[model samples]
Target: MRLIIAIVSAISRGLGVIAALCLLSAVLSVSEMVFVRYVLGHSTIWQTEFTTYAIVAATFLGAPWVLIQRGHVNVDILQLAAGPRLRIAMEVLAALFSLLFVGLLAYAGWVHYEEAWSNNWTSETVWAVPLWMPLLPMPVGTIMLALQYVAEIMRLFVEPDAEDGASRNTLFSDTAEGTRP
Candidate 1:
């Protein structure tokens, strides 16, 4: 279980790096586009499409990293009110629901990608970029998120208490009040 979690963490971190690079590329491309269009007095074609795709890809690819880092927004009022055992149960339930949601999304994304690949789908733009190129990130990201969710659920079972800082960090803070469970 520890090995699985470690592997998933590594994958999520790798994807996070790729997502950051994609965002950086998007920013640079947009800057270049502005310069070329305004300063050079030339019309840009691919920059708009490329930047749009890059930003969207970055969003999907970064989702798992966000989940692993507990960067997503959460309403912690109920958690704070609950008892230790209840808090653990709530966390497990949340992880399970997240896993289900992401798993379904991954499956749907794969289906769409398969269809696009089979039909040789391309964007209806001047660049005519392959649809699969942009769509590939959806399934990959969701799959990684699902794996992270599994890791979280496993941690709840393996370490019910908040002694394991990694597990606590993902679900809750290490403050005295927060570490009760």
Candidate 2:
């Protein structure tokens, strides 16, 4: 279980780095486009499409890393009020729910990718980029997110007493004042 979690974490971190690079590339591309269009008085073609796809890809690719890091926003008032057992139960339920939701999304995304790939679909733009290129990240990210959910569920069972700083501060502690532990 620990090995599985470690591997998943490593993969998520790698994807996160790729996502960051995608974002940087998008920014640079857009800047170049602007410079070419306005400064050089030239028309741009691919930058808009490339930047859009890059941003979307970055969002999907980075989601699993956010989940693994507990960076997603959560209103944890109920968690703060719950007892230890109830908290554990709630965490399990949340993880299960996330797994189900993300799993379904991953499945759907794969189906979409398959259809796009088989049909040889392309964007109706000047660039005519392959649809599968952008679609690939959706399933990949959601699958990683589902795995992260599994790891969360496993952790709840394996180390019930373990309290990470994010959970301790955001869920249980008073945010206005300071952390509990």
Clashing residue pairs, backbone N/CA/C < 3 A, model 1? none
Model 1 Cα lDDT, one tens digit per residue, 55-79 = 9889889998998888988787998
The TM-score values for the models, in the order shown, are 0.87, 0.87
Worst 10-residue lDDT window, candidate 2: 168-177
Q: Local error of candidate 1 at 55, Å?
A: 1.0
Candidate 2 per-residue lDDT, tens place, 1-181, comes to 7788788888999999999999999999999999999999999999999999999999989998998889987778997788655676777888888789899999999999999999999999999999999999999999998888887777665543555433422333344333334
Q: Who wins the lDDT comparison?
A: 1
Off by over 4 Å in 2: 160-181
The true-versus-predicted C-alpha distance at residue 117 of model 2, in Å, is 0.2
Off by over 4 Å in 1: 159-181
